[model samples]
Target: MTTSFPMNAGDGLYSYSKNSHLQKEIIDGAKEMMRDVIIRKLDIKTILSSSNTLHITELGCSVGPNTFSSMQHIVEALKDKYLYQDQVIDSTKSTIPEFQIFFNDQVTNDFNTLFRSLPVDRFYYASGVPGSFHGRLFPSRSIHFAHCSTAIHWLSKIPKELLDKNSPAWNKGLIDYAGASNVEIVNAYVAQFERDMEMFFNARAEEIVPGGMMVLVTPISGYIRLLRFFGSSLMDMVNEGKLDEFLVDSFNLPLYLPSPQDMTKVVEKNGLFSIERMELINIKSNLVDEVDAKTLMMSLRSAIEGVIINHFGSKIAEEACARTILKSKEISEWMKVNYEKASILFVALKRK
Candidate 1:
């Protein structure tokens, strides 16, 4: 098939790779949206009422270079908030202006790599926090704003089904994205996301100060065909049977994306916050440039990590990654639909 972005890099710094041209575009797009969201909601006067000591946290913060652009945008917005508040400053602002940042993610997260890239001279205080954000990572009522981008979907590590014998969601009679038909499997994964989100907010409610804000940009479900087309196409490969052996031996497996409404319910049910703004930005799967093959690989990897190994076999996993990248080359033709054009950006505030 034909592709534009590079899809060849496997074991290298993706952010520095040339194939990341389109990936860069996507990240930049996210950064821009973040800036817009901050300006639209974050009440500077209220936040900097007294102390500039607003504490911020970013979950799933990858390497510093990966999120550097977005973080810069966030800081700029806060500064603007400060400026706006300063103009109207009376003797009564309650919040302090000192900003301490918490950068959190799984322990295996490349904290050293990310920390190495941080701007040493930056004004804010940043510290690496290792752990799952869904759990209690921050002290109660200690955080002002908490953000997680493209990360929460990782549900408490993989389910034990892959290792246990009695689990219905595990291997055997009912094959998940790892075996053949994954409608049941993907749905189960999505179900977990619903719970993860619910817990995220409930825990966040305790961590975030009242009136604090949060913004998250993640892969949201809206495309109905994506789950079916991709899910079943792998099923077709399984029917051929070459794919199954590869999948079973692979180190990982695929997961699911929950719908927008489903996510909203989780947030509302938890009662920690209210959705302030939700924007759906569409991305044509084809628009993912080939030049950033690793970037694209990582993007798809997060969603379909072990599926290819199950369907195509480990022997061809690398090539499958190539083919996987090329497979999207015909994204326009895959479902004869607009392939992957819509994405979501959510902004909310902690309810008092």
Candidate 2:
């Protein structure tokens, strides 16, 4: 079975590993949602009482110190709930149950570096489980809580519809399905997103026990629109003879940003989970006065550099396709004039 997906898993190279400081809002948001959902929605007492071991899994936990921070928040909350339910506090004796944390990502992930860098004071029994979250990675009814942050926007793979030469959706000169005037192309991308989401929810449903909760932190539709606009601008640059069109045709990111309503539909259709809460928030960059082109370049590169290398050989992506650097510079200049904002959605759900 081919489990390959466009992933960023080089030790400290991935944007996920580097954007901890820049993307602190989302990270903190995920932690807050986990606490709120567990206390207000999930049956924490039942989960603690039913099993001697509590299972918490982080899907798409890229090589990160932030993941550890998020996990710590979760493990601590679980412990607090268990202690409160017990109605006793023993300073010397342990009242809380032991935790088993599974960190999941792609097969090519830097698990070694991730594991080696784990904090010595970590509370849970940590384990690395390499697999895509779009498919089942754990046994049925095994997990109590599932957490994913800034990851699900990534589709499991590129939509085959885009690659079909004869199909109306055959995105030829354009690298992305975004900004395509053709309704068929837009439908193709939406269809792929729906399918990937269904797969993601279905697989998670089987893994999480009834009453378990999942908190998904993903990009909102507006963020995707901005990306599409950026991608379209890049294509326009190629068309204007400023950049090579072949480079644009050769690269496309396998990512999607769905509306909160779209996400709710997938959860409802799946029939295994019920929505607890969903909210979209706009995250504005602190550098409001100026566009940090160099910073943006680093951020974008860390996230998709691996994908660039994978799709177009490293030499082509770096050397031959030097215009990409120019494109990033162009994007940065555009960012200066336009107020760039990232809208993200936080969804909390409970398995039925």
Candidate 3:
């Protein structure tokens, strides 16, 4: 498996910390649904019966601000559940549970930046756990509640078949399977998604207690329209003889946005979590004029600039990003008609 790349770190102009407003918007949009699900579906009594502390894990938590905001919301929601929503009839059972928040990501993620950006008055005791969420990161049955937002779409690695010249799945001169005319390339991506999701569910199943809850907020396949434009920009560079076609042929993004139906099948097949709620949320509704091409490119670049730099070196990657910016007006015009196609998938699952 290829090593996972971290987001652009630090507080620089191009860092993820500065350009993650899009992800923050998605997290904000899902806050109400997440709170409602926790109040109704989380078995607080079962969790409190075993321990006075609630262990919450945020998978794929990159360098701060958004991750901090999401965890704070969860902590407050759990407090509301414990103090108001729980059906514990005994008057003496009103004690609140202590919160332990685990921030998880790849080992290479900038934990120093994440730690420095943490909210000073936060209620939970925070700890950073570095590892892939596709495998176990904590002891078995240790987590009480798990949360992952706008991150589950990342596959553990790019499918190797896409790099093999002899394979039908070889994706030449393309950075991603999105908008690919070849079914083989798309199939290879889908296959990788299924395998990675299985590993993810299995690992979480082992870590979460039997009555624990997990909420996942991720983009649907339609979100790939933005990436398709990014790929087009690189291809445009290739045609202009400014970039080597071989670099484009060899590099592929290790990401997949699954449909709601696709996620349901994966959850059911695992048989460890029962679906509580699943729905498509219109991201456009959350941010109106903010979906313009320039803003989108900034967010996209912050998230994947490190990957590009690693694959094509700094000079070529910087040129590629600049070229994409030049096409902003055209992309903005396209967004006027097709923006609504993009949506976020929010899912609530209960451990069985």
Backbone clash tally (model 1)? 41
lDDT of 2 by residue, 1-352 (tens): 3335433555554444664443455677456666866667767667555578899999988776878888999888877776665664444555668899999988888787689789899988999898888889999889999999878878777777777768787776665655677788777777877888898899999999888889888866544433443355556666677667666665667777778878887888788888899987666655332245444544555566576677656664454234443455565656655535666788998888
Pick the TM-score winner: 3
Error of 3 at 342 (Å): 2.4
lDDT score of residue 180 within candidate 1: 37
| Candidate 3, 124-155: lDDT as tens digits | 99999999898889999999999999888888
Q: Candidate 1's residue-wise lDDT over 69-187, tens digit each?
A: 65667877777666666666754643336667888866755566567668876768889887766678888778777777665555654554454445455544333343335454555
Off by over 4 Å in 3: 85-87, 285-291
Residue 314 lDDT in model 2? 67
Best-to-worst ranking by lDDT: 3, 2, 1
Query: Which stretches of model 1 miss by more than 4 angstroms?
Result: 1-27, 30-33, 48-50, 91-96, 157-187, 222-254, 283-295, 298-319, 326-328, 331-337
lDDT of each: 0.57, 0.71, 0.85
C-alpha lDDT of residue 296 in model 3:
74
User: How far is 229's C-alpha from truth in model 2 (Å)?
Assistant: 8.8
1 or 2, greater by TM-score:
2
